[model samples]
Target chain A: MFHIYCPYCEEHREEEEFHPKGQAHIARPEEPEACSDEEWGDYLFFRDNPRGIHHELWVHAVGCRKFFNITRHTVSYAILETYKMGELPRFTAEFPEGSLSEKVTTEAEAMSRQEGVKA
Target chain B: MSNLVAQNIRTFETHPGVEISAESPLVFFHQRSGAPAPCTESRVALRERALLGHLILRGGAIVLDEAVHSVLGFGLPAYPNALSRDEGGERSIQWLSPDEWLLIVPGGEEFGLEGKLREALGDAHYAIVNVSGGQTLLELEGEAARELLMKSTPYDVHPDNFPVGKGVTTVFAKANLILRRPTETRWELVLRRSFADYLYRWILDAGEAYAIGVEV
Candidate 1:
């Protein structure tokens, strides 16, 4: 079984403490009444089934019972990083080949971008 | 009923005021399976701390900490997987999640404590759930107690991983319980009332080789 680092607990806990909750960052439509039937159906039922880098939502069911996101390599089963909700991931499909240092740089850039938008 | 209706939050005392026969969760197990008497040869000992007050506190840490400190004279455990106890050790608060904590106090004191906490935290977004009858605390001691736990849970029970004051809710055998280390030689299992018998049986079955006993 895989050991996962729970972002809230700040520790590596056994896999049994966590439950995989499909894809991460799927936002519900703000105006569902305005959307077409097909668009509504897509929002409700459609999810990415990718073989490479995947972002997943997981709940630490037994430990902290908090929901968080995991950026993982599906094929390699390597958890590149784990982050809390409302936080952006450093390693996405765009930076799939990014090294640890590259991830740090991008993470800083993402933080600055968020601040820029806020400002 | 009118007073309760006027209040936004509901709180109840599980313990009856009149003296009534109360059975611990392990009563059936102790009766049928029979507990071994603690002896010098016994490497592990188990005892149930029954009928204690179990309160689940849910709120922001700062607010809860302020109320707890004012009422209970202690603050909540600041770190995750940590437990903080009063100087006497009879009262304790264990961190369950970011917004949740478990406060356990001596029997017969919970109702008043809940009222005091509610008064201390007026109009704050918080909840206090009294769950005294729903669960019981079982204390395991002796040298082999840790070994008995290792056999049951996937959690790393080694002292290096589970140092004193660390507690976690984890799988125990096929069930779930809160495992905690209160002292160097003692471990506590907060077992649900329903699964206490099964867990007791599992512990006995696993600890047979170690000559485990029960201290009445």
Candidate 2:
């Protein structure tokens, strides 16, 4: 039940309007023919499962239908920021302290407890 | 005349010139479900604005705005999720995306409008898709219209969040449709030809408590 800010629509829309695309900032190799087998495999299958600060690609499926980036904390489920395509995220793993990590950790713990109860 | 304007772009009139009977998207629904008469007890009234011209215009906002203004006498909406209508409100242009807008006009006016827009736009990159047959507009009004919409869509229909002159493509029930607030009391739903029946039934089910009626 997350309310995500769509950069294109310039409003916070319900989560149902959005579809989360995998990891963000994963650029394709310029020359696929030049890459080795391992490099190509990594490009195709590898994705970071960072615990603190994670960037994700999401599309406003029901709204503007445009793709954008979201800087979210995995545990807390707090979306620190959402930016349009071709934009960079302000919060990154290197700057974990700047993100809402502490608050999200508590929220994540509470959410897990709720999930456990429901289960 | 349109052929000379842009060979790469394809534009066509969606309506036929013959006198054959045409049915709106809701014809079957109205016939099957039977419309309840509009009365003081009916809190919501649904009506179909059938056979209207619906065009999906894709291009740079500035270029499309200039061309639309030159042809339709009204520019594209300036902001996202905003709708601009003619003084008479018979024609409207709504911003669907950064580069996409929906232009709706009275039936029989779309083909000429598209041609004129092509001529006005010339070589600028653009696309005008006539979706008149692919979709239809349903007008919902009365006191319970907003509540009916809130039940169908997850998007907030509160007057504060969805003010007049705003439109958005959103999930409605199990389907997706375009929802617009044209006035304080009236809301419009643009449903695809395939999903109209499902949505109409869903609306009726949701509006039953309010004594919803279909105004044919």
Q: Kindly give the stretch of ten consecutive residues in candidate 2 chain B with the minimal lDDT sum.
A: B1-10
TM-score of chain A of each: 0.81, 0.79
Assess candidate 2 and give its TM-score to the true structure: 0.90
**Residue B60 deviation, candidate 2, in Å?**
0.3
Q: For candidate 1, write residues B60-110 as lDDT tens digits.
A: 999999999999999999899999999999999999888999999998899
| Deviating ranges (above 4 Å) for candidate 2 | A97-119, B2-6
Maximum-DockQ candidate: 1
Error of 2 at A41 (Å): 1.0
| Candidate 2 docking band | medium
TM-score, B chain, candidate 2?
Answer: 0.95
Query: Per-residue alpha-carbon lDDT of model 1 for A1-119, expressed as tens digits?
Result: 56899988888988987899999978788799999999999999999989889999999888788899999998998999998876677788988865466667676568667654211
